[model samples]
Target: MSSQARRRSRGTLYLALCGLVLACLGFGAALWAQDHTTWFKRLRGGNAWSLTYQGDAVGGQGSALTIRYRFNPDSFKPAHRIEQLGRTHLPWSVHALVNTGEVARVEVEPEGHTVATCRILLDDVRVVAEGKSPAPGRPAVCDVTTSSTPEKWPR
Candidate 1:
């Protein structure tokens, strides 16, 4: 190619690259803004419930568990309950009423493996008691705890 043509081609490539980078950054900023807005709304709404657990290795690997319950602001009924375990990234959520009581129990049992249990005590909107039991046959036990209130939650 001629020198002038090559220079034009390089300039076009650089412009395209810059455009792509700016597009990505703009998209990322938009996502971040949306997340921050949603979080702030939830905090202001004051109707979020959560349970976090760390359990022993059930099968061959350690267990990472999270239980989240979102309640309706007007009715105080659970809008959704999400439970996650292990490394599986499944969107497993159930719409049900999770009674607000002194204790909440969550258990996970991988097929053919012993059960890992988390017992949490609820004090109004805070978790007052948290405990975990290892899988039936496993000697390693996992400890579970709840995050602080929304106002105190880390950003």
Candidate 2:
């Protein structure tokens, strides 16, 4: 090919490479948007706990665990035994109606419970307990306690 022809071919190749890079970047952005919203939800019904992960982007109804926690009116850490959890990345949550009333929270207390009690690694920092919001004038929010860490385990 002539010099001019070679230059044209090189330019075309460069453009193709740029296009591929842009496509890759777009795909990465989409994945990030989804991952940013990826989360787990658990709603408590007295003692029984229902847990589910948002496996999809748009919301679905919900999911139920085969092993349910059948306990009294409510109990914290009502997990079905550590062995029952199965290796998983899903976050663990529990809601209990202690004498504290609707005020229940989830925290990664010392698994052995020998270290501490009610040590909160709080999530939803922006909206704290129902009244204690992060905002200045508004009282912090309160209702439930939730926290999560990037750490995960594989099943």
Candidate 3:
């Protein structure tokens, strides 16, 4: 082809490339905006719920051996145990925010005369579900399905 024709073809290709880049950028921005909106969050999970995991040394001094918990049921992976070198002190608590309709669970194993407790709370006040160690020196397991709550969502 002639040099003039080649120049024109290159110009068209450059323009097309610029348009494609602009289109991709616009699409990415739209998706990012949608994801940050409330409606998208509600559709994915609804609202954020609160969870608490606690342990107390009841009789003699007690320490927690391991604490296993899940904040999201879909992934269903227990968090890593406390990384402290020695046993973690009792009467300790952990708090987390999870998505609505997800299962909140906590399991605590106490060494010595300690008790483990787990509670799922709404708005940091209403107790959705709670469980304490059956007895001292035993593991306490607590689980609550967020969908079980009678209260409306997006509250």
Candidate lDDT scores, in order, read 0.42, 0.31, 0.64
Task: Find the candidate with the highest lDDT and give its number.
Answer: 3
Top candidate by TM-score: 3
Q: Where's the lowest-lDDT run of ten residues in candidate 2?
A: 49-58
Question: How badly does each model clash, as a count of residue pairs?
Answer: 0, 15, 1
User: What is the C-alpha lDDT profile of model 2 across 1-155, one tens digit per residue?
Assistant: 89999999999999999999999999999898767642322233222222221111112222222112111253444332221222222123343222212233322212211221121122222223322113222211123422222222111
Q: Model 3, poorest ten-residue lDDT window?
A: 76-85
- Cand. 1 TM to true fold: 0.28
CA displacement after TM-score superposition, residue 121 of candidate 3 (Å): 2.7
Stretches of candidate 3 exceeding 4 Å from the true structure: 1-41, 44-46, 59-61, 72-86, 148-155
Ranking of models by TM-score: 3, 1, 2
Candidate 1 lDDT, tens digit per residue, 57-121?
Answer: 33345333433333333324434344444532222223322322212334443323443433333
Better of 2 and 3 by TM-score: 3
Estimate, for each residue in 1-155, the C-alpha lDDT of model 3 and write its tens digit: 99999999999999999999999999999998966676554555435465665555555456788776665433233232322223677666767755556666767788746676656666667776677788876887777666533245543
lDDT at residue 34 of model 1 (Cα atoms): 69
CA RMSD per model (angstroms): 14.2, 17.6, 11.4
* Candidate 2 wrongly placed segments (more than 4 Å): 39-155
